[model samples]
Target: MKHRFSRMGVRGRLLLAVLATVAVALIVMTVAFNYLLSVSFRSDADDRLRNLALDESSRISISNGRVTLPQPTGEIQEFGTQIWVFVSGATVSSPNVEPNLQAAAKSLDGQPAQYLDVPEQEVRLYGVPLYYEEERIGTIVSGLWMGSYNYNLRMTLLATGALALVLLLVLGFVGRWVLNAAFRPVSRMTAEAEAWSIADLDRRFEMGEPHDEVTQLASTLDGMLDRLAAGLRRERRFSAEVSHQLRTPLAKIKAEAELALRRERNPAYYQEALASVSQSADQMTRTVEALMAAAQEEGSLARGRASVWQVLEEASASVGVLAGENGVRVRVEPPLRSLYIGVERDIALQIIQPVVENACRFARSTVILGAGRNGKEVVFTVEDDGAGVTEEEKDRIFEPGVRGSAAEAAEAGGATSRGAGLGLSLARRLARAASGDVEVTAGRIGARFVVRLPTG
Candidate 1:
């Protein structure tokens, strides 16, 4: 499967990837640049040391199997300076005694001449083994301080460090700017996508460049939105037409039934006609209710301040007669403290009544209505002693028309599922309208539905 970044948001992942790339590049650059700078400085230092040793080559003498050096006193020492010269033979007395010259003389290793730089003082030492026609005489040693070359290397390193810091800062800012600019089209597309709603789906996303990926995405989304908007329009138009068309026939049927009942001599005929008329009226009422719920769901709620307790009381009172008829008792456990919040009264009432009535319909004996504080929100739970929904059905239980296959086996007695199968669907929409949600509780023994509403 392709890699899916399901955890982090798109913007976060993009920024993280960009920053990581920049960080890796910066580290590699710093290391490589530092190494190159160090090598260059070291090469200059070595060259200066060698040149100093070669320039002083003539200032050497040997006599009596011993080496000597010219005395250059009172010389002002520059930075990184060091001087060392020692005797090559056992004799120490000489015309000009070289400091630490014996150390360089011992480093010959069978060579005629050799040069070494002293680490402590940055000084160079040259050892020349004196030879006359393959006969060993003695060695002449000379030393020169290299303070200037050490200072050069130090200054170069300091400059390199400062330049590297400035470059990193400039590159960091530039990289961020370029990245944001490069992704501007994507950002705009996302914002516009978020703003699109069912009411405004006819509006299309403005494409920047047709060949670009972002533009292609915008074109595809616009086409999809067009199809969806057309489908919704067709659905709404059909629903309204059906409702309008059925109204006249339903009115005629009800009126004729009432007229016949008034004129009928037989009491049985009157009762049967009235029952048929009442059933038709109930079906008409249910159809209208479904349409109303669908229309309301199409638009966002006009929120206002209202009391949670008051809405709950109203819903309970409305469903009280239904619950009693089904032999289900409902007891509301009012909150101990006065609880209030902002919400639409009608929507809230619509949401709760259906849930309570449905619970009562299937309730074997008792239906409990309970409300309490849930942190910053208020929660209501409607539970019944009926056969609770199974785990599989729980997912689609809120879906319209979905019910327990055993719904016929329940206490509802052969009555069809309530109100166009919109009890749960409408309830959920209304709950969301109030910045709330409805959830079906999963358990082994009972039917339970929980509703959550924000306190503000």
Candidate 2:
């Protein structure tokens, strides 16, 4: 039974559980009612037979050891309604009386009232001892037949059981139907999910205004699909961007190799060709690494605590040569508490160096790198004295391949577009990967890039 129940689906199990409860209730009620009915029947029979015996005994008289027996009444002549047998030693009231009744009367051992089973029938009876001046003369016993009452009880029980079973069966099916109706939304959700493919993620289970469990589940599934669709889009965009960025260096390398292979070249020519190829190869490698770092939406800097001030010092030192060559003075501010954030030292440098390099390339004089603790976060700022970004371009500064008007103007002046506009974008990505982020805030001077990471 346990295995059978376990094999059934949820609907089947629920239906069977309800039916089983109904069956138990019906059985209990039937048994209790039958017991009460039987008790009532026995009580009625006892009362009737007890009264009849006393009345009939009064009709007979006995004096001086000679008994005067009255003729049995017309009511007593009816066989099953009443029966009487006078007890005097071994003599019964009538010779032709039922032997079962005679036997029952003879063996009366003086109980107030009880049932006695005859050979072919059952009877409820009472024994009354006749008395003359407190001296026992004989015993008069009376009984009523229980065959008709028992027959009626059997018919009643059969009908009651049949009706109960019919009602339970009807209700069980109806309950299953009701449960199916209640779970219709879930059924629709399953069907929709089965029909969907990865390309169809935009289609949502738009169950209107979630007011119930089924609708709420549909809403949750829709939300999950939304996230999945967004992730897929990001992945596709990353691939396209990486391919576009790698093409330039690959073409450069191919052109250099073809020029070198066009004719027999001197050793110096071969050396320059190899050197050109190597530079292009390095450029391609850098481009790949930058794209990869930028595409990493979830950074791996969620562990390892390091001092923010120390990270700032290392980042400034790494880019110190570029700062000097670009004529941009770099300033590093010592934080008040040596605040620590959840990232490694190199990752911290990776996030900071790009923004600082971008700063130095376009800076008029000096770029300031500052760090401090803000609540549970470590906030770092890189502010430059270059031509600051216009309000209209502030939002576009960190977009991939989107150069700010000031950076474009700087490039127009032959100050090289250091790192192809991806540096700041990649900086933000790498910062975000560490459970941190960089944003362009309004700066009175040049663009102010603020980086915030969670304090460990």
Candidate 3:
């Protein structure tokens, strides 16, 4: 039974529940109506019988403890009531009393004043003892035929049952209609959401501010779709960035391998070729790891704490060779107070190294790295005393494959920029992956880049 109920559709189940509730209420009402009707009929019969007995007794007179019967004034009938009198071995009754009814009335002799049912004769009898000066006298019994009352009660019961059944049927139909009307929008929304999920993730319900359950549901589904669309965009961007960044190293490795295999060479020459291939392979590996790490969503990234100073020092040291080769001085300034960031040491270092490398590559004399706290974030500032980034290129330089005008000019003049224009993009991606950001800001005399991470 439980499984069968569970197998029903929601609409069917709701309809059944409503019908069951109405059925129970109808049953209670029908039973109560019939009971009250029966009581009303019985109460009328009892009142008639009682009134008849009392009136007949009042007309009688007693003399010296002997009962005196009153003359029959009229056809002593009211609501088909009958009366019987017994005194000193004599019996007197209303006109046309049947033998069975007389016998049924006699059975009430010497009994207290109360009502009794004589089902065989369809009569209800009530007995009252006549009294004079507290002396024993006689008894009066009144009976009322129950046939009409029983018939009316039966008719009322039938009518009530038929009406209740009709009401239940009507309510069942109305309840089904109401449930369908209520669930119609839900069904349509579910189907549309399923279709949109498969074919058009960008589609949204776009319902206005929520004022009801259905509208609230639409709002929630819209939010979910937005997140799914965002994740898909991120995946596509990650793929494109990886391919663009890894292509050069992969081609270099392939060229070296092909050249080394073309001819037999001295050990040193072959060793040099293998070493170049190895270096390219290493570069490819780093490129892949950095892209993979940056591609992760912040919620899925492994969380750890890293000292702000430690990560800054490590990022600066990693680009020491580039700074020395470029004749640039790299300086790390300690924070006013020790601070921590919410990302792991390695990931934090990865996030800052690219910006530092960019600074070292473009600096003329000095590159400064410093850390400070801002609200609930740890901010690192990297400044380089070189041709400052133009306002137009500051944001554009972070796009993959976009090079600043200075870097482009230096490359055209045969001066190495030592970058393929992916460093800043990777830096920004990794920082965002850790729930942080990297952005360029206006500097007093050079280019300034700000990296912000949540404080640990």
Highest TM-score among the candidates is held by which one?
3
**Stronger candidate by TM-score (1 vs 2):** 2
State the C-alpha lDDT per candidate.
Answer: 0.63, 0.74, 0.79
Query: Model 3, residue 456: what's the lDDT?
Result: 89
Judging by lDDT against the true structure, name the best candidate. Answer: 3
Better of 1 and 3 by TM-score: 3
lDDT of 1 by residue, 206-228 (tens): 77557877688878887788888
Model 2: pairs clashing at backbone N, Cα or C within 3 Å: 299-433
Residue range 1-456, candidate 2, lDDT tens digits: 899889998888998989999999999998888889888987887887778877877777766867777545433226775545554464446423566665776676344344565646466556777677787656667767787789878988998899899989899889989989988878888898899898885888899988998888888888888899999978865675566545445666777788888999999999997987786677567656655655663556566778888878766755555676678899998887758888766567667777777787778899899998888789999999887778887768888778888767767888665556666776777787788888887677777889888897
Error of 2 at 379 (Å): 18
Candidate 1 clash figure, as a count: 11
RMSD each, Å? 19.1, 8.8, 8.4
Candidate 3 C-alpha lDDT tens digits along 100-184: 7667778777777878887876778898887767865667888777888888888988998899899989988888888888888
Collision count of model 2: 1
Deviation (Å) of 376 in candidate 3: 19
Candidate 2, lDDT over the whole model: 0.74
Give TM-scores for every candidate, taking all chains together and pairing residue i with residue i: 0.46, 0.61, 0.65
Q: Tell me the lDDT of candidate 3.
A: 0.79
